[model samples]
Target chain A: MTTQPVTLRRRRLHEIVSPLTIPLVTLLLFVLILLLAPASLPKLVTGIILPGLTLAALYFLIAAGLSLIFGLMDVLNFAHGSLFMVGAYIAWSCNVGLDPLYPNHWPVTIANSNARFVIGLLVGTLLGAGLGAVVEVLLIRPLYKRPIYQVLLTLGLVFVFDALVRSVPAWGSDSKAPIKPSLLAGSLEILGRRFPTYSLFLIVLGLTLAVAVALLLRRSRIGMTIRAGVQDSTMVEALGINVRRVFTGVFALGAGLAALGGAAAASFIGVYPEMGLEYQLFAFIVVVIGGLGSYSGAAIGALLIGLARTFSDHLVLELGLPTAIASASTVLVMAVVLLLKPGGVFGAKE
Target chain B: MPINGRRTFQIAQSGIGYVPEHRAIFRDLTVLENLTLAERKRGDLRRSGDLIFGLFPRLHERLQQQGGTLSGGEQQMLAIARALVPDNRLLLIDEPSEGLAPVIIEQMMAAIQQLSAYTTVLLVEQNFRMASAISQRYYIVDDGRTVHTGAMAALRDNKPLVQTYLGAA
Candidate 1:
């Protein structure tokens, strides 16, 4: 009887604390900034917060795909980084392809950067999905039961993809500037502070994608099969749905999202061969921090990383600390999160 | 044709449903999702759903509830309903009355009998009363080999055989 009361109290405590953690962190930060560095509050909101959210959106875009595939198939796709990198490059290529025809062949981008960006995003997503399908069939299918082999094989595939990208001489340098679509070129004044239009777009896209994917998984027939298959795939096959085909589709969707993220990131940071691997590492950290195989967890993890990175950078500049320590903040946050909850913030119990 | 259990699992591409003892319903998905996913084709969903609903009307009320959230009895019904959704010539239901209330067991037994009328049911139940109720033939196995094989009535009469293989049927 005593133990039961203690357990109930703990459950009630958890119920109150867990959901509050997300927004409360940011609110507390805002309050702290307002008190100590009153002048920096607006800057933090515009410069740090908005951009951080945009970056987190990009990370979520990539990690969502990663989380879904790993959650369902128990396959850790190390080549996902390569997919992200290629997606950025593909988006860049699409921009170049559309540049010459500006106002001549395809008059859509003549005065409207919206059409151009949309087309570029579509091309990148489609290419990424196609590549994902090819990889799943050729590389992943044979290695499903042998999970250890999957890690080694996919890690090797990452190297192969990196080499292939680097071999393409026309691909140019990693530092090449991304397209500056006319419509997405300017900034918006929010409360008398300027905010990047592209960042706003990224945030919208990320949220929309989250809602859309959630609905698709929860409501649609195929999406239901995929969710169920993630729990028990062989049983799904017995139910008359081809689990392999579902795997292929999910793999493609994840790759497409990663590619889309890359393309979105390309608008700001541009594309590079190694960028894929770097983002791949971030995706892993975020997914881990959030939870394995959990979409919402991945998103939460992304937001935390994004906010932590911004906060660390601001702290470094403000306090005149070494700049190198900025990168470590993400790791520090992750270490702390893992320490508190090994399964991640929203992960299932082991 | 010689039937090896391993080969049967491997070769049978279609027309066979195996509900393993684990109650292999998609725990993460909803009851409707589990049932709808089992359809061979998108056509005739209404007809099949109505039929399943007729058997287990409780499932119709809990359509949106997740499979894993359901009680053991509900899950069993979902498993059976899911198997019946697709056009299957034979259903291999393993241990239907393992851990359930006697009232629920009675309901499941009745459902199994009704299911057998439409599709051939190959039930693998341990409870002697459950096995004998509907089964025409019974196979008693011990030490991984068949010890007795005959009609259910004959097996009932053979008390020594029942005692040896099934520990008193």
Candidate 2:
């Protein structure tokens, strides 16, 4: 009895301190790297850091949904990447059109590339959200009681989505680069370095979405249901909440975000049949590094990974190391983070 | 007889508030959020705040603290307060005294006793003293079957029945 108050106070203290550990260590390491690296500070900031932030923004686009879906439902949605690919394809079709020979019937034509690009993003997000809702109702809702079947169903969806995209008459497994609007096509100088204006657009978009999502999670009634449902869904149900409906809502929200990410990526990297799978892999890594079901974790994880990959690639180019090392760096960081904190940086303690 | 609804949430929506044995509050949420989410309809919580706060003033004090941070006794109070937030027709309280300190149990019993003046309580408890203290009637179940039922006063005087079933009342 005498020790209880002390224990509770100590626990509160630990809770306050634990979340800061990873970010502080990362910042310290970043400072150390800055001091030791041969490249000038301005060069590193322009050439490496800005690009890293851009990539991080893109990763967050996909990973946020992955983290939310996994956190709430405990389902490892392999098709998340496939959904990302579909979004890209949709955005591509909107911007570039399926066939050049056919009269461009799309209301906003290539003549209005900027409007078309914005329209493509909106359409992709809406359709992606719609598709996600449909999938949850038709496929996932029934398999809630059986864990393995849910896994199989989602895994199978990857192929289905991939095949469906490839089957599109003009798309036909070909990589297509959508035309960039003239307004955003040019480069902008950032801190004495020229950077793609579109990359900055992506960074801004990512940060905006992150803030919006955080606000939703923190403030709204639906957000309350989500946070509570994530912790103990059965109890939420017992408290008179329709957790199943929330599940569907979350799944749709995640899908919409991933689709938005894909649409945005299409403008940056162009779109291909396998674009989703490539981005999905990094998104998964980001989710794992940030902690499963943790949004802030995913955001930070994206930043860490984006910067890690960028810096490692630069180092590889400068030192003439194997290209494989650049790719391996993110995974190496994951392994080390897992070793130190197995649940991910923001993961709930087991 | 069948209840009004099919699902747990549906039944909950049908005006039944359940306080589970383990005090299954949303540990991650603040005490205020836990109460706010319990509202069945818009402004239900605002309408019911006076009664809840009156019953458990400690909860009002710890509005911003996480449910998990609360002590067992405080969690029990929050659980009961959560149930009271919605205009529940009947409250199903399970083992309010289970694992609580004696002082906390006495306070819980007093709160239940006062609330009973306004609401119907279906309390399932093994603590005979706490049960008898707050209740006007009693039922004895032996192996999932009710073997005896009577007024609390009658049961207290019936020493043989208590000895036979409850083993030294």
Q: Pick the candidate with the highest lDDT.
A: 2
RMSD of 2: 4.1
Per-residue lDDT for A20-55 in model 1, tens only?
464455456545644644445578689788888887
TM-score of each: 0.89, 0.93
Per-residue lDDT of candidate 1, residues B43-65 (tens digit): 63566776788889999999988
| Candidate 2, B23-91: lDDT as tens digits | 988777789999999998889889988888888999999999988889999999999988888888889
* CAPRI-style class, candidate 2: medium
Q: For model 2 chain A, where is the 10-residue window of minimal lDDT?
A: A1-10
> What is candidate 1's CA lDDT for residue A223?
75
Q: Local distance difference test, per candidate?
A: 0.78, 0.83
